[model samples]
Target: MSLPVPIDLHVRSYGRVRESDRHAYAQLVLPLDGAVALEIEGRERMLDPLQAAFIAPGATHSQYAEGLNRSFIVDVAPATLDPVVGDRLHERRFAPVGPEARKLVEFMRLLVERGAATPALVAGWAPLLLDTLALDAARPLSRLDALLARVEADPGAPWTAESMARCAGLSPSRLHALFREEHDTTPRAWLLQLRLARVCAWLGAAELPIAELALRAGFSDQSALTRAMRRSLGTTPAEFRRRRRT
Candidate 1:
C-alpha cells in the first residue's frame, strides 16, 4: 500500500452526550467549530479550534461536545506513518495547533470542501501536519476551579446539586445559574458527565467486573448502568468492553 494512503478523512459532528470507542487506525480531530471534551487512555481534555486531539491505534477514547460541533478527521493506517513519528504521536493527546499549521489546515479544509483533497495531497499533508504538532500545552484555569476539582477527584461520590452547591458555597439556584452561564449545562448534567467519564476511565481494567464498576460510578445496579451507558453512549458496558479492551 502507498505510504500516503489514509484509511479515512472527513468532517464529523459529535453529540452532547458522551460516547466511547476505539479503532485500529490512528485519528486526528481538528475542530471546525465549537469545542469537544475528549478522553483518551483515561486522560481528559478540551478540544477546540485552537487545539486538536490525536488518538493512537487501539486506544480507548470517549467524547462529549457542547452545542454544535463539526471537526475535520483523518484516520491513518499504522503502517502509513514513520515508525518514529507514529510512536511519538501515540502519546499526543491535545496539543496546540500553531498559526502556520492552522493556516495549512484551513487550506486543506478548503480543498476537501472543494473536492480536491486527492490521495497524494492527503498523504503529503497528513505527515507534515503530524510533524508540525507539538506536545500538549499547559491547560487553562477552569472557571469553576475549586468545585470542579472536588467533583473530578471524587466523581463516584453521592453528589447532589444541593451538596455541590454547599461545597461551592453557592445557593442551588445560583449554582445552577453559574453552570448555565459557564458550561451551558446544569449541575445535574455536569455531574452525570463526570460519572460517565469515570465509567470510561475505569472500563479498561479487564479484571474489574462491569457490575462492580457500575456501582462504583454511583449507579444503582448493573441494569441502571446499562441504561445510563446506552442513553449516553449508545452502547452497553459489555459492548464497550468487547470493542475497547486492549
Candidate 2:
C-alpha cells in the first residue's frame, strides 16, 4: 500500500548511527551546520554544509556527525517522487544543494516550526524540492565551478590566483584564461566582486562592527572594505545598512 503523504522531515544533531539501516523510502540528508560522514555500500563520503547525500531506498548506510552538527533528513517515497528525480537519486549519492536548495530547505524548516506540516503542504512542496535536487545533479560543473563553490562556502578564506590554480589543477595562466572565457574577468576581480556583494548583503542583515564585518567578508580591514564598497556602490557600509533599514 502506498503512503498517502510520503514526505518526512527531521532535524538531527551531532550523533552517530552505526547500525546499518535501509529503508523503503529514499532519504535526503542535508548538513546545515558542521559536517557528516556517511558510509554507503562500504564507501565513505564526507558531506559539508553545501552538499547533500541521497540514500537510495534499501541501500545499506550509516552516518556520523561531527561536533554540533545540525542536519535535515527528508524521506521521500519512491512512488511519490517524479521518475526523473527518483532515478537521479539512485544514480548519484551526493549533490551540491546550491542557493535554490538552501532557500527551499529554509522554507521547509519554517513550515515545520510553525506547525504547518500538513499533508497538502508536503504534497505540494516535496516534488519541487526533489526536482531541484535532480536538476542540480544533472547540470555539468566545470573545474572552476567546483572551486567557486568552495570559495563561496567560505568567502573569508585567503585566496590567491596561484592558490586557486593549484586547487583547480591548472596553471595560473590557464586559470586566468578559463575565468576570462567564463566570466569575462580576472580571478582576483571576480573574487573581489563576490566578496563585495557578500559584504553588502551582510551589512543589510547583521549588526556586527565595521571591522568585524570587513574581516568576515575577506577584507584586510575596515578601510579596505570601505574602499571596495565606495568603488562598487559609491556608499559606505554604514550608509548601506542605513538604507536597508529605511
Candidate 3:
C-alpha cells in the first residue's frame, strides 16, 4: 500500500471522546502530553507520552484518547519514507519520542506555520526527520538522501537510471535493484514523480505560463506536462492554478 506524502504538519487538542477519527493521505500521531489507545489493523495499542503511531494513506483507524489533551499529526508522503522505512505501512506500533523525534516535531511545526514561501523549495527538515526515524529502526537506505538531493537540485534535468546511479556511485543495474527494494518503483518513474511534485508547487504558487512551466519542469511540451499532471495530481495545470488563486 502506498503512503500519503506529508506536505505539512497539524497539531490539535481535543477533549475526551469515544472516538477521534480522521482520514488523510498520510499521517503520524504523536502524543505529547497524555496516553491514548489507537485501533489500527483491528488491534488496539496504548500510546503513552512521546509515543507515536503511523497511519498509511487512507488507513482506516480510530483513536480513543483517555484523558488525552494534545496530539501532533505530521503528514508525509509514501515516497518520503518508503525508501527508508520499507513497504510495510503499519510497522512497529511504538516509536519513542527520542530527542531526534522531539526535535523533528518542533521543526515540522515551524515549517507548517510558515509554509513554503518559494516554489520547488520543500522543507528539507521533514525528510531528514524521516531519515532519522529510519536510522533508528536500523533499515537505513544510504543512497536516499543523496538521490533526493540530486533530484531537488534540478528536477528539470533529464534524468535516467544511469544518471541517478552515477549520482549514488552505483551501477545502473544496481541502482534499479535497490530502488525496487526500497521504493517499489523504477528510478525513472520516481524521478517523474519528483518533477511533477515540483510542478504542482509551482502551479500552486505562481500563474506561470503553461508552456514555460512545462519547459521548466523538463517536459517536452505543455501537453506532456498536462497529461502527467492529470495522472499524478488529478487535475489539469489550468485547474490547479485556478484553485490556488482562490
The best candidate by TM-score is: 2
lDDT (tens digit, per residue) of candidate 3 on 153-204: 4678887778788888899998988878766888889878767766766776
Mind sharing the TM-score for model 3? 0.47
Candidate 3 stretches with Cα past 4 Å from truth are: 1-141
Can you write out model 2's per-residue Cα lDDT over 1-246, one digit (the tens) per residue? 233457877787757655467877788888766788887777778887667888887888888765667788878887777777878866888877755665576566555654556777766777888788788787765557667756766778899999999998999999999999877889999889878867766676667898998998789999999988899889998888888778
Off by over 4 Å in 2: 1-13, 16-26, 31-34, 40-43, 49-51, 56-61, 67-80, 96-141
Can you give the lDDT of residue 118 in candidate 1?
87
Go through the candidates in order and give each one's C-alpha lDDT.
0.75, 0.77, 0.64
- In terms of TM-score, which candidate is stronger, 1 or 2? 2
- State in Å the error of residue 227, model 3: 1.3
- Candidate 1: Cα lDDT at 111: 68
Cα error, candidate 1, residue 230 (Å): 56
Top candidate on lDDT is 2
Poorest lDDT segment (10 consecutive residues) of candidate 3: 113-122
TM-score of each: 0.52, 0.66, 0.47
